[model samples]
Target: MVSSSQPLASLIGRKILDQGGNAADAAVAVAAALAVTEPCSTGIGGDAFCLFYDAKSKTVKALNASGRCPEALTIEKLRSLGFEGDSVPNTSAHSVTVPGAAAGWVDTVDLFGSKRLSLAQILEPATELAERGFPVSELTAQFWKRGEQRIMNASPNGHEMLRHGKAAPAAGEIMKLPNMGKTFRALAEQGKAGFYEGRIAESIVKTLGDLGSTMTLDDLKNHSSTPVEPISIVYNDQLRVHECPPNGQGITALIALGILDSLQSKGKRAFLDAGVNSVSYLHTVIEALRLAFADSKFFVTDPEKVHVPVNELLSKEYLAKRAELIDPQNTKAVAHGSPANSSDTVYFSVVDKEGNACSFINSNYEGFGSAIVPEGCGFVLQNRGSNFNLDPNHPNALAPLKRPYHTIIPAMVTRMDGSLHISYGVMGGFMQPQGHVQVLLNMHHFGMTPQEALDTPRICIMPEEEGRSVVLVEEGIRPGVVEGLKALGHEIQVVTGLMRANFGRGQIIVRREDEESAGGHVLVAGCDPRCDGIAVAQF
Candidate 1:
């Protein structure tokens, strides 16, 4: 089963599966297509993380294709320039992180795929669509209109590609990206080397330099994708949680789960009480995130440069100690020490008939990704650079060839029997971990279907600096629960007509205890209702 936010994209995955590809193959194909069709959320310029579960081995492997800072970038240099702020300078040059999506695709395919498609073959649809153009989706058009100034100021090439020398393209306008076509062509012929070391790299370096950015060819050439072991925690007798490692706050999700596990083990299942547990769990997790993110801010640099105790963070003793901070009845207003820049990202999942699975999350930071289209590359550069702190003393401070604190995280859950249980993810900067915990609770605690869990009203506790903590609720949340939450001191914000799609865009695939496979697309899947994304099965 393949699930995506777009039905057409889902159909593409189903088509690949029908053609005899496994979950990983189909997911890669659909993701490639989505890069072209859903450029507002993700593209070749972004970074990706994935967890692939292999049925034959009953083991899961993680791929971290997160981008890296340029070799010339350093905390001292950034501080010396006096560009201190929570936000990164929004320009093509400053926005560009070493892109890892293409490399991720290559690595995933090389490691697990059977009938390998050349980069050209896999990306041919995107290239053709880029050249011939496709209608701008309503979502993309909205973001373009709202962010036109930044798009224009990001880079000359960006202005040319996004606006065709005019203002930002309107909704339904035929948008073409000939440069992306050229980049795809080179990748198809030369593989990753084409993008990292050849003309594509040269174009990126020159464009960034021209825009006063510090990226160099060496930074491009030295980028690599690492396979890391996922962090796991036990939730109950049957369920186990897994997430990407540091630089990403996926551990926040684990922390939340651990807290919930403690509550459930005590036989506390009151629905409203469970809601209280949910909030409390989030509170503790946020505190842990505060500490972990403090480390992320100051110490979680590239694994090559810093020593990260991956095991210690996920240890039971640490989690138990963290969970002890939860107050079952009170809502605490936590402080947001620093804000990570938000990104427009996408998440999708695939589960094959044989039960192999892949949960993938990819992002380009903000919408249109710093809007810096490299001349002749056909894609916007990612503003993941904004994730770095400008402060010289910060752990996540800009450093030569270092990985920034990341937000995109792919999630997986397995049964004790070693079978794939679920593949899922939520997009949004800080909200990702919060969303993941909510969905997991809805499923594991409430026994909801994947769709029911994802479609349910969601709440995100914004960084406390926003002062009043606002919980944006979807249309269907229990009114009494809202009242109860309000009574508990949450500043209630009733969002009419979907306040945030990120709260609901999660996609999931589940393997039931009986060995049946099921899949779900969130309510936002109907953003383009006319498209076809029905989940299918083959016996």
Candidate 2:
């Protein structure tokens, strides 16, 4: 088994596997290391969800470690302060949510790890780098330059980091955060308690309060992570699914799969070719998302407080009803639904020699999160609070200790024979659900390799708009395909080079029927690629 992403993270995963760690153990190690090296995309301040496939048990399990809104956050309080519940400011102190990453990382390792590493052992690399600093990547530097001014105005600490009066740091410049180092150290030494109940919590509360934020120590102390059952749909005798219940949009992926399944069963192979059928399939997928998303927006709130009849959501009847809304020959205009959640997230997957596999996704809503870097902490706090509607009547309205609608989702695919097929995830805000569906169709229906499937062109329907949309056709898609799609009444947008942002960064590990595992990286898709990521296989 191995890891993907930067060469360093890939090397770490291989090292863990070399040291006899199972897939879960190797994933944990790679995840922890990536939290530091890929800070622009993810960190400990975010939340995580994982799907695991255990070959021995022939069972799949899901771990939901998403963050919750501060318990003190209530509609009455926001109203008292003249804040509109439906229009909560994006960067306000009130937008901060209780961080769930620390708990998630620890819990995942505890539950599935065999050769478990201590928190310090897991976090040592990140802590050292945060303390000493590392050179910024060119992409990160570009975001930094564009975002510096806005970040500075976000919070006082933000200004300190961006050095408000100065220019943004260049690509090779050292980016350091001693405060984040201290926070990681505390977490390493004390685990979850260090971040949730002790001095670390105290500091977070104080810093938030100082910035006129509403989060309190009680919010941190009372936070807990819950496990939820995953949802699945059978397509071509294969199970395609993701975690269900509370704060995740995995259902969106299921809905897309169901739609594809219907199209395929109807012998609609014409859509498999790069032409009108492709555009038609995209339109149907988007329409399905629009309808399903409406329910998610209205009914999918904190599961502990709201009884979401998940069975109803995933039932064949429910999916069938939703499917009936799709038009086989036409495109539908869709709107960007009310913002469920928006964050800069990352995804990674792993499969080991033991036939064990894991698919994980993590995020800090928006880049640098709330941009509220507590003194001595290298990481930014999550602004998951932005996911809550200010409208008191909405199920996802801001309530004391409620979890906002989360976007991070991890997915798994298995053959009908109970053989694990793929552990994968796509990283983007609302684009995640759409990406999941597209990739699945690319693999199962179109019969493309994982790399080719991920590398294919993609289209995203505006969540709230009905007919208007943005479609990204990768350079590889045939020109005739684009013309055919445009003829189908889609507002096509062409992107130069690769279509990274419009699509997503997809990483996957596939365990073939022979029990041989392979992995692939999302970036560098055009280069010489292999299935097992940067992993060295061992028999």
Winning candidate number (lDDT)? 1
Query: Which stretches in model 1 have alpha-carbon errors above 4 Å?
Result: 90-92, 163-173, 266-301, 335-343, 466-469, 502-504, 513-539
TM-score for each predicted model, relative to the true structure: 0.88, 0.88
lDDT measured at residue 120 in model 2 versus the true structure, 0 to 100: 70
* TM-score, cand. 1 vs. native: 0.88
| lDDT tens readout by residue for model 2, 1-539 | 55455444666666666766777766766776666656556777788888888879878888888877776667788888888637567687788888898888778777776555665766666667667766665655665576576556665566435422365667778766566677778877887888898877877888889877778888887777776677787875556555555678777677657655665666754555644235555556556666666666666677876676667876766676766666656666534353232326777777776678888777776766777766545566877788788877777778877788888888888877777877877777777787788777777666777777776766655434444555555455566657866776766666654224545567766665433424321211210121112433443
Candidate 1 on 270-364: residue-level lDDT in tens?
A: 33354533544434434444444333344445566566666775676765665555454655644334324343777888887666788888778
Total residue pair clashes for candidate 1: 7
Q: What is the lDDT of residue 467 in candidate 2?
A: 40
Clashes of each: 7, 31
